[model samples]
Target: MVILTQACPIQRPFGSHLYKRRRDFQLLDKRSWSLKPLIPRVSEDQDTDYQLRAVAKLLADEMTANGQVIGIGTGVAVNEYLREISERLGDGRLSGVRCIPSSDVSASEAAFLGVPLTTIEDVNGNVDLMVDVADELDLENLAYIVGRGDNGPQANQPSLPRVRQLLEKARVRVVVVDIAKTGRRLGGSVPVLIEANEDIWEDIAEELDDIFIGDAEIRRRSVNPDAGPRGGNSPVITTDGNMVLDVQFLEGLKLFGKDEIYDRIVAEIETVDGVLEHGLVVGVARKAVVGTVVVSAIGEDGQEEVKEESGPRVVHL
Candidate 1:
């Protein structure tokens, strides 16, 4: 029954509605594309590794020979996709493909892998396809939780505002995740990570704490034992100089359930004055690729050996 007294309007949801089509190009029109039903591919190798590779290949197939302005997302699975795209670029299967990276780590990986890069402004903010991984994916609604710091603060994860911009501009937004990252219903098992203005982070956290019944805290930097507490020990600052707050939910609380409390809380948080961006990503992905691993055998050495590795499958969102 808690409420935010100074809440602002929640930002409009990011989705196909936000995409702007180029007058001259029909390829940018997502309506022209049709997603196929889930098709499972099985391989006999490292289940996780094979699944990641299969996903990378699937994303590479989305690129046309004429090239595409792709939005590259961060994380390990995404890195594998970048490598796949780079290999295709080297072999001339796809040319003129320019990538707009979502984070510093992704940009660096793309550059190192020889994937052509461009800015959103240079491309006039028109993206053919966006492929990024999700931290927590809602299978039914295609919603996800992003920016939860899988790579740590040094990875320079893109701010929520920037993510919003990229998603808004992209014509086809696709999310990739391992099957383990997905769930039919999202719950309070994960903290809701929020970014707020540095000056007002404490205030924002306090407000969120009240809303969540004292479940919010300002995320701090990890300190090296040898270095002790230095300036690095200060609160973690995002690439945009904003502070991140890890707001937990009451134990045993389930989100996105029958009561739809998740939607209500999200609206409340969005209205909070100093709130910048939040981790909950809903209605942004047009489709998702979920990588699954199946262990088909138990080896004599006590290691899991799959007779066949299950590859990732595409799910229409």
Candidate 2:
């Protein structure tokens, strides 16, 4: 069996807290009362690199078997994290752990580093843990969005679906991310990537009156002399072997309500023929382990004063 493992360096210890507080309530009846605000606090401090290192350690510490397989998703950010993990594992910090990467890019990187690779078929009855970063996560943690890179379609391919299936089989799914990616609302910071079939791409773009095509851009894995237009002239590609249409919203579109907005758009798009997959991820992560770092400076009196600097936190699965 092939073993996949990676290592990353850590500069400090990081942690996050999740708290829920009930607000004051007035009793109107014996069985009913008007409750006030319920607050949920999530706090973390760490840079993108630091959070990735911390996540590697967390995964290594939590993994039970030496020869067990772990799944990693693709992206520039995820690749950095994997590089750190692979480095640490190379130094003997972690042993006998194999990796199953989410994309061709990730698979190539893993193979280059001498890490063993496996497919869903290779580990037919074994447990595989996938750790990936998300573009957005909502308050209830029910909805998530990913595939911000130009390779949305490939990113969602058998890798994502297969990981979801494996996680469901294991009865648990863990997501690792920095705190900045977590918020009460979704899509405010990151734009959603939607994949539509070539046949219905034009029709769907026309039907979604709320969605506007932002720009025409090329979707290439890397720069190639044989490739088509480098910038605006190139065509977009989806992972499912279909064309992609970039959809945007006007400044004042009616997207106030989350459920209503998602329902309306998803329902409309699904009804259209030849729609392969949309970028809406509902109920993605069951649990998130966020990592934050605290930096301390030495004071004049030779004492240390701790200060928090924010960048990104790692969400662990």
Candidate 3:
């Protein structure tokens, strides 16, 4: 068993706990919310599009009219929800609400609908709310393995820094997601992606073997058309002009006793030359609102039963 040591405990932003409680809000309306029965319907068997729709409705309910919303990413799931929200607001109802999209792709889509564009810096330190999709999340509600869309780093560049700075100042931050992402243990299901500098790629890869009990490989990202000709066929690119290495464990490897794994990976690999940001996303969001989709099933007696399954749910944070 590999035991990684912790150099420093992650400090909780002051007043984070208080802000977490205060900011947390539920969007489901008991009166209006309804789930189609599964016995004859089998909604869960069909894909999680309904879950995504539910999440969109929930967001629309929570958002105030004529308010600013910061949207992150251009993934299919995120885009679908954004479209639903836009349609719900329709013409003049949300005219005063400006949507600051994190990625160019998202900005283009939102702009087509007359949604005003704002830079991430515009919402710096004081965004009314932010909605984004994630790759993985753990029990601590800490996110790992992000940046699926080619534009994640750029979109988050301004907003994330300012948000963290404000957390130190106001001491509050909120994150929201679906229940499926809330894993029981860290690293068991979700693979961690480490973004490092391309200069020391080989050295960092070698060090990961000593620090973790799993296989670690650099992430190769293909440049998108919008990124222009400067983008290369490099495997990974860090948010701060670095590289990304995706670490995966052998099948059936439990993530127990790996609390300090990130610390060791950071301490050892960061020492190498040309290393940049690791994919550790702890303390980024102080609070999370996890949305769950409950599919209804009709039993033989013609009664409806709600069944809960993990995954296949749209998330926001």
Candidate 4:
């Protein structure tokens, strides 16, 4: 839960119109913004759900051997990937693949769909490959921003350090995301998340400004009761009982150098007392499953019709 919401976009992206349900979504500066594009738009008709399946099938081709351990990341598109994997395994085309989910939400969904599941602590072997989602990705630099999901997954990110440890144990890493999620520049009102022990949140919040790249602000996410049980008037807690703080660059935001901006910001933040983890993940994925958009031109009169003309693009990392 990050409370730094930029000014509302004129219209949200096509595939990103999902409703928010978590009670911890209260924004601190609801009207703050940098007057820059938050997320670049794609003109093509986006069928991300379909594209995600296409990518999953491409991944299924790798589950050839028995007892493959796969790492699943959080995001709206993960369900689509899970469904595809479950179907393939059920049909006997794939076999003996146990999944390691990054979040509580992911574990429940994987089990409900009948996908074999295990935890990082229980697994005896390395993960074959990890297929997860990203919030903002710059393919050229292999840069990624994860854990910006709308609701539960946002809270789920406090567990990312554990996921990273497991990711290191994987032979390969892959990120599957709709192409609409990619952006050219690395700055804006993008949130940089932090998780720490609940008792030390205030200390961490006070030190955020020292590490921020520009005019960024931080706020602890609070939960309201009506939204859900785990959510209430108290500040929302991660599954690990940690407090979450969202650091959003408010204005004068700019990120250009390869690792200069990202690395410096992350390094400084990590040095902050009580800070445990942040949302920046870089150079891990060896492959990218990009869901491309194919927009058809308008004919004679002004009429629009959609069709799935292209499949996802698979780029080597």
TM-score for each predicted model, relative to the true structure: 0.69, 0.56, 0.54, 0.67
Tens-digit lDDT track for model 3 on 1-317?
23334222222211121111111222222211111211111245545676566555544554334665454444455565567657756855554566655455666677776556665456563445455444444534344434434335434322233223322322112233344545633443222233444455554554443333333322333344333211255443434344444444443223222444333333444444444444444432222223244332222243433343333232233
Model 4: per-residue Cα lDDT over 43-140, one tens digit each: 35645455555555544653224677888877555676688778878888678888888888888889999999987668765676566666666654
- Model 2 misplacement above 4 A: 1-47, 84-96, 125-127, 150-171, 188-199, 209-233, 249-268, 284-317
lDDT of 1 by residue, 59-157 (tens): 565433466888867777678888987887788777788888888788899999988899889988888766666766676655666776664555556
Error of 3 at 72 (Å): 2.1
The RMSD (Cα, Å) of candidate 3 is: 13.7
Winner on TM-score between 1 and 2 is: 1
Sorted on lDDT, best first, the list reads: 1, 4, 2, 3
lDDT of each: 0.55, 0.42, 0.40, 0.52
RMSD, each candidate, Å? 12.4, 17.1, 13.7, 13.8
Best by TM-score: 1
Number of clashing residue pairs in every model?
A: 3, 26, 11, 1
What is the clash tally of candidate 2? Answer: 26
Ranking by TM-score: 1, 4, 2, 3
lDDT of 1: 0.55
